[model samples]
Target: MSPKASKPLVPAKTDPAAIRNFCIIAHIDHGKSTLADRMLQLTGVVQPRDMKAQYLDRMDIERERGITIKSQAVRMPWEYAGETFAFHMIDTPGHVDFSYEVSRSLAACEGALLLVDAAQGIEAQTLANLYLAMEHELAIIPVLNKIDLPAAMPEKYAEELAHLIGCEPEDVLRVSGKTGEGVDALLDRIVEEIPAPVGQPDAPARAMIFDSVYDTYRGVVTFVRVVDGQLGHREKIQMMSTGVTHELLEIGVSSPEPEATKGLSVGEVGYLITGVKDVRQSKVGDTVTSANKPAEAIIGGYEDPKPMVFSGLFPIDGSDFPVLREALEKLQLNDAALNFEPETSTALGFGFRVGFLGLLHLEITRERLEQEYNLDLISTAPNVVYQVTAEDGEVLTVTNPSEFPEGKILEIREPVVDATIIVPAEYIGAVMELCQSRRGQLEGMDYLSEERVEIRYKMPLAEIVFDFFDQLKSRTKGYASLNWQAEGEQAADLVKVDILLQGDKVDAFSAITHRDHAYAYGVKMASKLKDLIPRQQFEVPIQAAIGSRIIARENIRAIRKDVLSKCYGGDISRKRKLLEKQKEGKKRMKMVGTVEVPQEAFIAALSSDEGNAKEKTKK
Candidate 1:
């Protein structure tokens, strides 16, 4: 027999007159998902026994990663001001990489529950999202979460919210998502404060697709906010992107509980059943209009964000190329943030130069590709956008090494980033030192609390492209949180450093370097490349050069005696088999005439270990 399910604490249904459509927005780990889970339980949408930490993050990878990667919707009926109403709650992603996804979720709602950590207070991302909500004209309801913690400072946070977001201090609701303290009051405020979405239900079916994900069994499951009309199951719908029409196989409103009702109406947030198998077909930010009477096109439905960082992602093993490509394709079907193309590497092998929103985004994508898809990949170092002035007086955006200007350029500009870091007050000195070490200029600092400070800095996007966070975490004992935004371009004396392994330039290992650190960086790169490239039949020269000047060079001595010293007599087939295997392996190596350059030589050239080790030695 199956285990008995627990009964919901609150009644299943309440008066529908008090309904409110709102979403919870916060920086990562600020308790948005947890608060949603608590609200669902309090509203009887989910039972107490069935409660999970982040129920909205149903994806296995999300649960393991402890981050909400996608936006999730749920409905709950509650009572407020002597009236019953349905509350459609959307839980949005906090990371800036998913800013587009968050915007889509906000478009579906009329109000937002901005969750701020009581102890940590407002962060850069929190402020950014608040501005986004204001741009959308959504009613912002500030909530101070984690009030039950010993370090909680609800009053201070309330004041900050009022000052930062222009919301009244008294209007900020203090609630503990952990202990459920003051949670019901928040629910009541939601119904009282948030306005009901106004729209006619009889108009032609017009829905906005805020987000979409691919399902193996369900095809494309699109989350939409019905804007103008009522949609019914089996109704024909036209997607704005491809103009391909598809019928709604199913229509349903999501609840914290699985047994919720189906078929949602106007002003309600729910899912549509597009029989289309590809998620890309139902692009997020597209419009779904009635096939019979489509209205004047949905304006600004979805605008693709330009990728700011680019890098090559290749399989560690040549044989895994096919599997890696399949994995990326599958990931793209679910994540619109990831973009890539087929690319070739002289040292690393076949791969794709994938573009991402930011450094964090790149890391998350790489981690997901490896963990979810079970593929091993070699990633090129991340690169920021560079403005190159050509000899013809035309400015070009160069992201890849191949696109860089080949002639003497007039000037080179790199993208600068405004970075904000929050850390414990005791670690302020260390954090400052760390930032300065990365060529960062201190902007300003603010004391968030007696023991915590938020430091602002202007840094080159190229500085933090690698494991800067790891260094910060180590220095601050994992207490520092970083947030940054592109701050346009800055004139820099920068040069493209081309790395050559076995005399041939490895484009994937190339980088834009500051003139001050060119020599050091070149030596470090050459050393690393020497380690990554395997020994071949001939000695390989690893060189790093800026234009015509060679700054650093390392050599991998040829295998002085790779030839077999002795051969067993009469075992001609065994000897032949060994020789053929060696020959095939040698053929895989890129040959510059008689010289065979192994793949490892290319990878070592890009490793950060060489630079890190040199820095340690200098210290």
Candidate 2:
């Protein structure tokens, strides 16, 4: 007879329950997702072999980028102390650009698992996110991860957490997400230490929509944390902002695979299906109340995030303009932080002025728009917020160069950013040199460990706004990590360098440069403009100037004769059509006096290579 199969042990649901609503918060690549996987395995939520890396990062883009773009929620039934509990785990985005999304994820939870790298300790972004969690009054369970690494220093990290968050150092949990050591104990502590949801569930349905994104089939999926009462699937709900009422079609707790639950109670996070045709209708932070029985309105729902970086996104091909616009609209449905307005350029054709949270956010957005949507885009140089005072004493915002007042006889303020860089101690000297070259002032330095150093810098936002992270990575051989925060505007000696093609000013090719590097930057920009701007019918003089002073000049010699002077037999119509298309293309180009310039001239003129080349040639 076959041996009787042993009965699988089932966790008891009575007595001390195992349910814990919590989220993991950490800086990018500090092991938040890795630790989450380990937690699932330790709790028997997923087998060790069945587990995949960043399982919650289900989006194709997220998997390719190895970053969590959207917050994810998972339910794991675990047993501790002879009682079963449902652990609702939320994984949040680590980058500061998605801080708003992180806040929304935190609002849905009663507690947080603050994951700090044992060797790296607290970073600037980590501290920033931790503060956001504190504001929500979420109970924090500090965990020091990466403890298995040879350089791990759990005790020091514990002390840092104690100092930074006012938590006890001895009480900090040290666990190796890689080796899965001490993970089981951390799970037990989460059930024992974290407090349960306490809001009144019998009250009228009042849910807070923290973040939302558009789906093709699902329409709008709004992530809400029920503050009071209960929300069930197919229940009628009204949006406080727009007063639009709809029935919840489907309800889930997270993205990708939402748990098809009946209802979500107080302090529970879940998604609502309102059949919202547009994502803007279910705006993030909008209050969702019952149409029949409403509760006290949620005031000051969410402040509109101010975009710091601005740029123009145009299509490379003029005919693809409509496609680009549609792509942007689709992207906006998912990304609430992205702001855009329809714009047209003589050189770039149709485009839009896009606002982003910061430089990284801008790059990521552009990359996604192109890669995900399969659209070719021509992006103008990124710009910072500029405060300009008019001649009549009226202040105006100037994000684009064309909007700048021609005769601003007053002060101009440029955005400043607080930057932090962490690097191996051996590369400290080189890193400091590069930062100083970019006009960065050393604020202070903290010795993170015997081999690593964290340096702080107060830098002009313009200096490090472009390619600074790339430069830092290259100099440190990919060992350095950088994080920055906008430090408001500061009065600076700034001048706009205009690059002229064929002795005529191309407004789009202008950039604001520091007075110190104006000449060098101008020369480099002029050279690049020459290379990118196709040689026109007439010779184009690429000149860079600061106000009335000419700083640099390059000449893009015009094509002497592009037309075939000798015509062949029986090909006149085809050749004529080709010539007509070329003429139409030339009409799209910006004609600056005698020469015709392409759209790429504006972009190339803003590059550092042109400036560097000018410096070399001058020397």
- Model 2 Cα displacement at 349 (Å)? 1.3
Best by lDDT: 1
The lDDT values for all models are 0.78, 0.76
Cα-based TM-score, every candidate: 0.83, 0.83
Tens-digit lDDT string for candidate 1 (80-151)? 667678889989999877787788788888999999999878876787788789888998888999998899
**Which residues of candidate 2, in runs, are more than 4 Å off?**
1-19, 42-51, 150-170, 299-302, 423-454, 475-477, 531-539, 557-593, 598-619
Q: How many backbone clashes does candidate 1 have?
A: 15
